[model samples]
Target: MGIITGGTRQGHEPELTGVVIRSSAGHLLVAVDGTIWRCQMRGRLKRGKRQSQTVAVVGDRVRIGAQDPHAEPPRGVLEEVLPRTNRISRMAARRTGGHVEQVLMANLDQVVAVQSIAEPRPQTGFVDRLLVAAERFGVAGVLVLNKADLPEPADQKTMWDYFVSMGYKVLRTSAETGQGGPQLADLLKDRVSLLIGASGVGKSSLLNLVEPGLRLRVGEVTGKTGLGRHTTTSTELFPLAGGGFIADSPGIRGFDPWAIAPRDVRDYFPDFAEPQQACRFRTCLHRDEPVCGVKEAVAKGRIPRWRLAAYLSLLGDLEERAERLGPRKRP
Candidate 1:
C-alpha cells in the first residue's frame, strides 16, 4: 500500500469498495467488510445530478477514493456507482423532482413491510402501494404485522386475511414477546432484505430482537403525530451472522406517488391484468370510462375498490405531473 495521499488524484484514484449503509449530514457512510468509511460527494457525483438530493443514497455499491484521514474533517471522493440488480424507488419529492426516481434501496432480494396491529393501525392502501412497487422491481415483499402481543382488531384481521389470500408472506411479530422471531430469522437467511414501514411500527425493535448485537436505537412513537421519531438516522446495510444484509431505513410516514409512468402503473398491481384487459377502452384508466371491466368488477365486488382506487390515485399523480412538466422541448 502506498503512503498517505493528500488531495484528489483522478489520475491515480484511491478506489475503495463499499455498499452505502447510510446517507446523513450530506455524507454517506459506506461499508466494505466491517469498517465503514465516511465519504463526501465528488465533483463528478455532484455534477451528475445538477438538481437533486445530494450524492449517494443508501444501498448503492460504489468505488470511493479515500482522502486524508488527518484532515480536520475527513472526506473521501466517490468515484463510481455500480449497476444495481434491482432498486426500490418512490416519486421524487423535491423541486428537482421530474420523472427522476429517488431510489430508496438498491439490490434487495426482499422487502418486509412492518405494520402495527393496533395503536397506529395498519394501512392496507399503503401496504398495497408498497406491494406494487415491489412487483415492479421484481423483488419479493412480505407483510410483517408487528406488535402481535397486542390484539388484532377486526380491520387489521381483514387486512391480514386479504393479503394472505393474495399470496403475500405475512408475519405476526411481537418485538416484546419475541413472537415470529425464528420465522423472520429463517426468511432473512442468505437474502439481502429491506425492512420498510410507517414510522413507530417497531422496525428497530424487531431488528434488535433479531440481532441482539445490533442494538439500534429505538424511537418513541409520538402520539401527536402518530409517527416514530427519527431513530435509524441514516440508511445503512447491516450484516446478519446467518448470512444476509438488512437496510434499516429512517422513518417513512407517507409514501408519495411521483415519477412513475401511467401506462406502467397497472402492471405493478398484479391483480389488474386478466380483468383490466377486458376494460372497454384498451387504455381505460378504469375511472370514468364507460363499461370499464374494472369499474364493473368493483360494482360486483369482484375486485376491491381500495385496490382500484390506489391505481387511479397513482395514475392521476403521474398524469398531473406530466401536464405540469409539459413536453420537454427539443432544442
Candidate 2:
C-alpha cells in the first residue's frame, strides 16, 4: 500500500526499510517483511561520482518508498542506501582510461573460499588470492576443500596442514557423502557468509546439501578446458533455515583485489606479516633482499615454498597494476 502524503513536500511521505536481495544493471529486488519488491534506484544514487561499478549489491540495506498496491508484483522507488559494514571487491578489468572497483558482495561477516580436491583440480593460486582479498576487505576467510568423496591427492594433506598452521579455518567437505556438512553449517550459522570459487568447484552443490530447499543449478567442468561452466549468472542471497544469510556469487575466472599498493601486499598475507618484522631492512619485500627473514623461513621449511610463490605472483600483479594506474590518491 502506498503511503498517502498530505502535501507535495518530500518529507511528507513515509519510507519503508528493506535489504537488497538481488541487483542487476538497473533494477533490484528488495525484501521487506515477507514481500519482495522490485525497485528502481533514485537518480541521485546512480549519478554520484564513484569508482564502484554498481550502486547497490546484494546484502545492502536500503530505505524505499511505499509500493503501489495495484501493481502486479509490487514496485517501489529506492531512496537511500544504508552504510555497509564491509564488502568484498576486486579491481575490474582495466578500461581505456582507468580501473574501477567491482563490488562482489556487501556486508559480509565471513567469506568461504571453496576449492575442490579433484575433478577440476585445485588451484592454489586462486585460493590464496581469494583469501588475501577477503583479508584486505576486512572479512574473515574460511577455506573449504570440497569433493572429499574422491580420493585425496598426495599434496592435499600437506596443503591442509599449511593453512591450519597459519590459523585459517579449513574444512574438507563431501557433498555426496555428507562428510563435513555439519561443521560447515556450524561455521555459517548466524553469520552472513559469501561463497566464492571458480566454476565446477561444487559451490552450488554444497549449498544445496547444506540448505536442502535451495535447488541451485549446478554445472560440470568442461571436458576440453577442464574449467567449470558459469552456473550462477548473478549474485543472490538465501536465508538459511537455522539462522543467518548466505550469498552465492557467480564463479570468478580471475580475481585481483582493488586499491592494493605494491609495498603493502605483505600486510594482506597474515603469515608473512610477522616474519617480515624480523627482516634485515625495514622495507624488505621478502624478495631479492639479503638477510631476509622470510627467505630464511622458507629455506628452513617454516613456510611452504608454494605459498611464497603465490605471494610473489600477487606482488608482481600488484606492481604491474600500480604502474598502469599510477599512484592511488587517498580517498
Candidate 3:
C-alpha cells in the first residue's frame, strides 16, 4: 500500500497518518505527530476480508480523519490501515467455529520470550512455541530467563545451554538485582520489540528496570495457583528513553500457532533442519517414522530429547487442528 500523507483526499477533509500505539474494543490510540488521537475504525475497513482476526493492532501504521476541533476528548475515524512489513500471530478460537489468526504485534523488530527461573517455574513448552512462531514469521527471537537472583535447577541450566547451542540468544536476567539488565536494555535499544510470556515472568518488572520512568504496574503469583495475575489488561507501546519502542502485552497461559499446516511444522523447528535431512522419507514428521534422523540424533545425544518432545507435542496439535478443519481450499 502507498503512503497516505496528511492532505485532502478527493476534496474531502484532510486526513492524518500515524502509528497505532494501542488498540482495545475496536478503539485505537494513534500517535499522530506528537499528539495521540482516540479513533474508531472506518466501517469499510471492518467489512473487508482480513488475514488476521484483528483489523488493527499495536505497531500498525494507520491513517485517521482529522480530529474534530469541538470534540470533547479529541476523537477521529481510522480511515485506512497501512500494510505491515511483518506480524507475529497465534491461533485464536472463533466463537462460530474453527480457529482464526490473531496478530499479536505488527512491524516488530524482535520477539522476546520471557520466563522466570523459579517462583512459578519455567514452561519451556511455551518458550519453544514462541521461538517457533518467531522463526515462522521471520523475526528475531530472544529468550530471557528472569529472576537470576534465584537458584536455577540443573535441568534448567542444561536446557539454557542447549538453547544457546541451537543459535538462540539466551540472557539470564534478574528484575530485583538488575542482573543482565544492561544486556537486555542494549538488545531492546532503538528497536520495536514485543515482550511475551506467561504471567509472573517479570515482563513488566524487567521493563520497569530497563526504563524506570515507565513505572508499569507489576503483579505477583497467586499463592494457591502459583500463576501470575493478569497485570496488563491490554497491549500498549511505550517509547524507550534510549530510542525505539517496546510493547508489553497481557500474559499468555498458552500459545497455539496460527496458519501452520501439519506438514510444515518441521520447518519451524530449526534443530530438526540438519537432522531431518537424513530421514529415510522426505516427508517425515519425526514421530513414529522409521529411520528418522531426528530420532537417531536424540538417541545419539546430538539433539536434546526434550526438544523432540516439544516438537511432537506441537505437531500433534497441528495435526488435530487440520483434521478438524478439513482440507484447506486453494484460493
Candidate 4:
C-alpha cells in the first residue's frame, strides 16, 4: 500500500502527514495511517542556526515526502515539522560548551513523575524539577509514588498529601500487587502522557502492569549505590488499548529546564505565588530578601520548607548557568 493517501501536494509531490512515535540517532519512526515509516529528516530542517533546540521528537506531527515505491518497508523523508502544542525539554548535558535544549517529547497532555516509596528512596528534588518543567511547558503534571506496597515513611506520606493539596494528582501505586493500576490506567486512558523518573523507579514495571502486553524490561536498584539501573535506553511512544498514547523515556539522573531564567523560576512554583505577593520587592526571588512573604510562610509553617529549598535549588542552578552563558531571550 502507498505510505499515505489523500495528502496535500507540495510542489507536485504528495506530502504525507504522521506523528513521530520514536526518534533516535538522527532517525525517526513516523506513524502514518497505522503504518510505521522509517524516515530521515530533510537536510534543510537541520541546516539553520537552530542548534540549541531539538528539531523533532516523539509526539510531534510532521509532513513527510512520498515514500520510495519499491522499498520493502515504508521509508520517507521528513519534509517539515508542524507546530507543536507544547513540549517538555531540559538542558542536555554537554561535554563541550554551550547548552542544547533536549525536547523529551512534544505535544504531551500530561507528565507522570514516578518515584518509588522506598528501595532507592525518593528524589523529591528531581520530582520538583520535572513538575516545574511540566508547569512551564503547559503540560499537566502527575506525581506517582510507585512500589506503594513497600513501607512508606510518614514524612513521604505527608509530602504526597502536600502535593495533592497544591492541586497535583498524586497516586500511590504498587506494580507488584496491582494496586492503583486501575486508577493509573484511568488517568492514562485517553491522554498523551510521558512517564519520567530516575532509574530503578519502576517506570517500566508500572508500564508492564498497566499494559502487560508491553513486557518492558525492568531493572533492579543496585545495592551498592542505592540507585536504579537504566532499563529503557531510548524514548518511544506506545499506543494504549484504551485510548491515546504514552512515551517511555530513559531515566535521568538530573533535570535542568532549558531556557528558564532565574527570575522566571518562581512562576512555575505555584505554592510561592500567594506568599510572594507580600514580598517587599516585586522581583524578590525569596532568597535572603528581607520581609519576604515566602520566607514568612515557611517560618509560619504555611508552606513547606522543602518546597522553598527545591525552588532555591533550581533557581540557583539557573542563575549559575546564566552567569556562565549570559542572559537568554525567552522563547
Candidate 5:
C-alpha cells in the first residue's frame, strides 16, 4: 500500500492518517503527528471474521475521520485500515481444545524473547517456540537472557551456547546492573521490536533500563509459585528515546503454535533445515523413523539433546491437540 501523510484524503469527510497505538475493548488510540485520538472502528470493519479476537491492533496504520474537531480529548472514527507488512501471533485456546490465532502486534521487525536465569526460571521451550513463530511469520528473532547476575543452570548455559552456535543472536542482560543494555539498545535502534517473555522475566525492567521514561509497572515473582504476577494487562506500543518503537505485551505463560502441523515444526528449527534434506523419507516426522537425519544428528552430538527433546515435546502436544479436534481442516 502507498503511504499517505496526515490530513490527506480523497472524499468529502475530513480524514486524518494515523497509526493505532493502543486498543482496548472497542476503543482505539490513534496517534496523528503529536496528537492522539480515541477512535472506534467503522461499522464495516467491525464485521471481520471471528477467528481473531480483534480486527485491529497496535502498529496498524489507519485513516480516521474526526468525530469532533474541537473536543478536549479528540475523538474520531476509524475509517480504513492500511495494509500490514506482517504480524506476530500465538495460538489461543478454544473451548473444544482447539487453537485460534491471536495476533499480538502488526508490522514488527523483530521479537526479543526474554528469559530469566534465576527467579521465575527460564523455560527453553517457550523461547524456542517464540523463535519458531518468528520464523513462521518471517520476522527476525533474538534471545535475551535477563537477570545475568543470577546464577544459571549448567544445562541452560549449554543451551545458550547451542543457540549461538546455531546462528541465533543471544544477549545476556541484567536490568539491575545495566549489563548488556547498550548492546541491546544498539540492536533495537531504529527498529520496531516486540519484547515478549514469561511473567517476572524482566521484560518491563529491561525496557525501563533501555528507556527510563517508560517506567512500565513491574511485579515480583511470587514466593510459592515462582512466577511473576501479571503486570501489563494488554499489549501497547511505546516509542523509544533513541529511536524506533517497542511493544510491551502482557506476560504469557503458555504459547501453542497457531494452525501449525506436527510435521511443519521441525522445519522451523534452523539446525534441522539442512540435515533433514538427507533423510531417507521426504515426509519423515523425525520420530521413530528408521532413517531420520534429525535423529542421527541428535545421536552424533550435532544438535543439542535438550532442543530435540523440546521439539518432540511440542510435537506431542500438537498431536494430542489434533487428536482432540478429530477431523479438522489444516491450513
Candidate 6:
C-alpha cells in the first residue's frame, strides 16, 4: 500500500482509472474514461529499479491520483500501470552494448505496417524485419500499402499478392483518393492497432484520411531524397471515431530485432514457422547448415529470396556478436 505524501490537506485523493495517451516532456497525458489528465512520474517511484526506463507509453492502462482533478484541465502523478497484454518495442538505443530498450508502445493488439507505394519506394526487407519482431512477440501483423495514387511505380500488384497469399491482411489505401479508408477503418474498429513504417510512407497522411478530423501535422517529402520529413517525434494513442484505438510512433526506416537472439530469428518468418522443423539439423541456423529446408525453400521459389537474405543477414549479425562477446576474459 502507498501512503499519500500529503500534498493535499483535506484528504488523500482517490486513484482514477486511465489509459496513457502519450508520454512526453516528462508529462503523461492519460485519458481517464471520457476525460484526460496531465501526469508526472514521481521521483520516488522512479527509484528502486526499472524493468525498463520507459515506464509509461501510449496504450498503457494506469491509475491516476491528483489533489486537484479539473475536468477540462487535469494534473496528477501516475501512481501505477496495469499489466499489459502485449507490447511493441524496437532495438532501444544503447551505449555499453549488451542491450538497451526504448518501448514505443504497450498493449498493442496489432501493427499496421504502412508501406508507401512511392516517394520512398517500399522496402521489403524493412517490412519483413518488423514482422519478424511482431511474430516473436506474438502480436498480430497487418500491412498497409499507402500512396497508391502516384505515377507508374514498381511493386504494385506483385507485392500485394505476396503478403496476402502469406495469410497476412493488406490494405491498399491512397490518402489522396480515399481508396481503402473504410476497409482499413473497419479492420481497426475494435482493436489496438499501432501504425509503423518508413519515414516517407505517408503514415500521418493516411491517418488523416482515415479520419479527416484528426488533422495531424503532415510533412512534405524531401526534394533531394524523395523521402518524408519527420513530423511525428513521439508516440500517441488516438481513439478512433469508429471503435478501437490507434497508436502512432516515430518513423522506423529500419528495425533491428532489439535484443532478440539470432538463433531464434528464423522462427519469426511466417513461412518459416512451419517448415523450420523440417531442417536436417534441429539446431540449423538455416544459412549453411546441411539440408536446411528454409534455404532450400527459397531456392525452389517456395519462400521469397529477399526474405531469406534478410534472415541470413540477421543471423550473421547475431553470430558475429556472440563471437565478439565470447567468454569475457577475467580482469
Backbone clash tally for model 1? 4
Estimate, for each residue in 289-329, the C-alpha lDDT of model 4 and write its tens digit: 89999999999998988989999999988887777775563
| Poorly placed runs, candidate 2 (over 4 Å) | 1-13, 69-72, 95-98, 328-331
Clashing pairs in 2: none
lDDT scores of the candidates, listed in order: 0.75, 0.84, 0.86, 0.87, 0.84, 0.77
TM-score of each: 0.87, 0.93, 0.94, 0.94, 0.93, 0.89
User: lDDT tens digits, residues 208-259, model 3?
Assistant: 9999999999999999988999899989998899988999999997887876
- lDDT tens readout by residue for model 2, 29-141: 88877678899988888886788888888988888876573576678888877898888888776662336788888888999999888888888688788888888778999
Candidate 4 lDDT for residue 286? 93
Lowest lDDT 10-residue stretch of candidate 3: 91-100
**Candidate 5: which pairs clash?**
none
Candidate 1: which pairs clash?
21-235, 21-236, 22-235, 91-258
Q: How many backbone clashes does candidate 5 have?
A: 0
Superposition-based RMSD of candidate 4 using all C-alpha atoms, in angstroms: 2.3
The clash count for each model shown is 4, 0, 0, 0, 0, 1
User: In lDDT terms, how accurate is model 1?
Assistant: 0.75
Comparing candidate 1 with candidate 2, which one achieves the higher lDDT? 2
As a whole number from 0 to 100, the lDDT of residue 1 in candidate 3 is 16
Evaluate candidate 5 by giving its C-alpha RMSD to the native, one decimal: 2.3
